[model samples]
Target: MADNRKRRPINRPKFHHTTFATTKLHEMVEFYEKVAGLEPVHYGDEAAWLTNDDANHRIALLALPGLKLPQDKGHTAGLHHTAFEYESFDQWIDNYLRLKADGIVPFLNLDHGMTMSMYYQDPEGNGVEIQVDTFGNWHASKEWMWYSAEFAKDPIGAHFDPDKIAEARERGLSFEEIHRRCREGEYKPEVIPEVYLPEFW
Candidate 1:
């Protein structure tokens, strides 16, 4: 007997928002507001909901009493990172410089073929990534991730020196030029070691 049942694909679900429980709720709110440019749409006594978009909240921070910052361990099971996408390279660079001016450093910068990303840690040590797509559209970026030979060689992405990138920008290098160099692997910035745990899945 042939049995057939319609099953939902594993990748069908869309990502919603991510919530974090932190004792430093106020500090967390400030970090997101200042660094990520998010606004607190809903501010309550125990929780704060923030959004950069029209959605009710893109990120939520709950007041947790006596919550100790989690230690970074290779085996720790928790939230890996939350990523925010930017509309343009200029916007991404502007935010990066703004954070840099505030003395907030990104722990990692990478050319991911499909996107350029800068990873930072919040005051509570939660990972956050700010990125802009390499391609003009989502469909093209998705296809690039799957079919790009560069990505096939290194799916985890290649490290780049954020300082060098900043220097290039300061020298009046165009975004298009920088982006092309990154894609073609000609922008040889000093590669830094990745700090995050490797993905097993």
Candidate 2:
């Protein structure tokens, strides 16, 4: 018999996928297909599995007919949100603009010190976070998340205007420079967006 305690460092498992059960399965699937850049590898009425890259499926949608919304949301114990990370700032910005053109916009955008994040809501009102590691590498970003004073101060981070950030990118500002400006409160919008809380009906 192997002793699990023999392992010095706790082995962390890679997050392979997330499954969501929804009454509006089709709409939820469509939302993932559009917002997450995912495609249905094998889709059906009752269930659908989707992926953006090769590792089989990254998102699974299960249909539950005649489902009732909990009496109160944002208080239920379940998955709050799922996040997808883009490889580069340009890619993230481009995606944001593309979605904006498609009439989809993030409800909230924040610079989490470690990651510049954008939050969106699906058709089923599920929250989704799209992020880019501002430090441009996992190791540095992980370190910052662990020890950076900025992150320690306010973990939720400061809000940023997505439109202004897009404009800054168009005007040739580097990702690091833009991140600094955002952290220093250069692009706060006149009317800050409210954090998304699911409605009753």
Estimate the TM-score of every prediction.
0.84, 0.90
Among all windows of 10 consecutive residues in model 1, the one with the lowest summed lDDT is 192-201
Model 2 agreement with the true structure over 1-201: per-residue lDDT tens digits:
977575544787888998887888788888898998899999998999999999799999888787777555655676668999999999999999999999999888999898999988887777899999988889998998888886788998889999999999889999999999999989887778766545545
Error of 1 at 107 (Å): 0.5
**Highest TM-score scorer:** 2
lDDT of 2: 0.87
Q: Estimate candidate 1's RMSD in Å.
A: 3.9
Candidate 1: which pairs clash? none
Could you say which candidate leads in lDDT?
A: 2
